[model samples]
Target: MTSTVAAIFVGFKQLGIADETDQRAIYSRVTGKPRLSLMKPPEKDAVLAELRRLGFTTVPRRANGRQQLTGRAAKKVQALWIAGWNLGVFDSRDDAALIAFVKRQTGLDHASWLHQAGDTIAVVEALKAWITREAGVDWSPTGKRDAAYLGRYGYKIAWAQWRILHPGADRIARKGFDTFVVATTGTTGMWTEISDAEWQKVMNALGPQVRAARKAKP
Candidate 1:
């Protein structure tokens, strides 16, 4: 069986540069300088060799440290790597920080699922839980009533807030207002039907702040 490192090394050998001199020149051209250590059998590839020359190893050298992970653990790590890379959680792929973040979010050291299920199950579960906790959505239904219902609940507050924010010509048509009520309240429409333009009028009348406030509350 070919190890990942060995596979990489073999690929470079197959490149068929005549000798060490040609190999060194090619590496220097690509990476600014030749890495003597990387000219050997176990090491090759300019970029990877450059990383090694800078004391950066893909597998940590510390005893019993998490050098590499496989299966579900690797999947979870990959997910975190992509997310952390995009969200600027870590400047580069820092395995230790990525693992720590996953552990903190999922409350487990490994990517074992809640039950023995699929490989990505743990990643999905962790993300779902984390998103629910951090997404800032109000889980409860909006519970926003129709205009008449609102008036009944608290007449003064309802009337004041529901007062047509738009001009008379811009106000929602009677039928459209009824449609908006049915859509928002999930109840029967109070009046006749209307076109899309009328629906827009109704949405405009309700105003963004009013809708946002309702969503924020419930």
Candidate 2:
């Protein structure tokens, strides 16, 4: 697999594009997000134009839309994808509204949002800040703490189940403590869904820590 492709996958946030025909194929098509490096030339121009409109200069970035991505811009784009996908940033089902939401979100240079939506290394740091500064220490699931029980930080678990989802995979999020439910027929377990062993194999590589973590849970 190419790095760019890997980047796209790594960057994909599961948001359905306005024209998306197959909702299930997000994982397969978004490999490492090599496509992350790619901008619709128009999209790139618009982004640059926006930055300039906001008074930032268009000094040549290591990665420009017309050219192969490079340096900070490439990394930043990759980070955006990672954050977007990790956050499960679903906009309203309306395509136009969702697109507009995304533009407004990152455009403001939103610190907290960016921290949540960025790459692994960056997200961790942002998460630390988010927990400490914004949330003021993690709280119990019920918003109260008891002596015997410990609570899980939700944002920490935000991406926990993500690996189980694959390209073109149909995942239905369950209620609290809900592992994503999967089935073929767009729902209804009677038909049942087929899970690719290959995707499972990728998950297995998460190694002993993840394995033990799964084991430690019910």
Candidate 3:
């Protein structure tokens, strides 16, 4: 097979789309070709673009010519680690447990650094979904509770203001605040489920810091 044809196959495999019938369906949709071997240059380009649109990141080759995960895929790996930590599935210091979790989830017996971009993305998404279902909190790419978990009120007012004051804060900061909310409110419930008074307590506790940060920004 030509390099382009090989790339197309690799792209599909990375997408975790292994069924020949399904692969042919996508191939037909992109190139109007019934078979990958029949694809022209333009068709190949189109199919590759479609794969990228579907969240496929081309794994970069190392100096030794081995394929390595991309930076974006690495972040997903980090997020998975944090999610595992937060869920109490493993302690923060347990690298072996994280590798084991990935092994169980993806059936891949290597560390994330050795994973292909597609494998990393697939595993991260699957793990995040599992964490959300188990913990009753939507997980973000940053490995913290998603802003949506705070619901309309908490997100719109409290989080909005927090972001305004701490515009440069990283995901770790956001995670810390999320941790505080869970601890203070004593539940992972959404804004509607939690009392207005409880929300007020969060605001009261953090409001001064927000104001001080705003003042200090200049």
Best by TM-score: 3
For model 2 the local lDDT of residue 60 reads 25
| Local accuracy of candidate 3 as per-residue lDDT tens digits, 1-218 | 65456666777888899998998898889888978678777677677778767866556467776544433355556545554343333344244455566788778633323334566667767666665554333333332555433453333334544454556545445755667766778877454566655765665565556555545645
Cα RMSD of all models vs. native, in order, equals 17.9, 18.6, 14.9
lDDT of each: 0.41, 0.32, 0.57
Put down candidate 2 lDDT per residue, 136-167, tens digits, no spaces: 33333533443121232322223243332322
Per-prediction backbone clash count: 0, 23, 0
Estimate candidate 1's RMSD in Å.
17.9
Model 1 lDDT tens row, 150-218: 323122212222432222322234334444556754445533343333433433445454445434553
Q: After superposition, how far is residue 145 of candidate 2 from its true place, in Å?
A: 23
Name the candidate that leads on lDDT: 3
**TM-scores for all candidates?**
0.26, 0.20, 0.32
Model 2 weakest lDDT span, ten residues long? 176-185
Stretches of model 2 off by over 4 angstroms after superposition: 1-73, 90-102, 106-159, 162-218
Candidate 1 TM-score versus the reference: 0.26
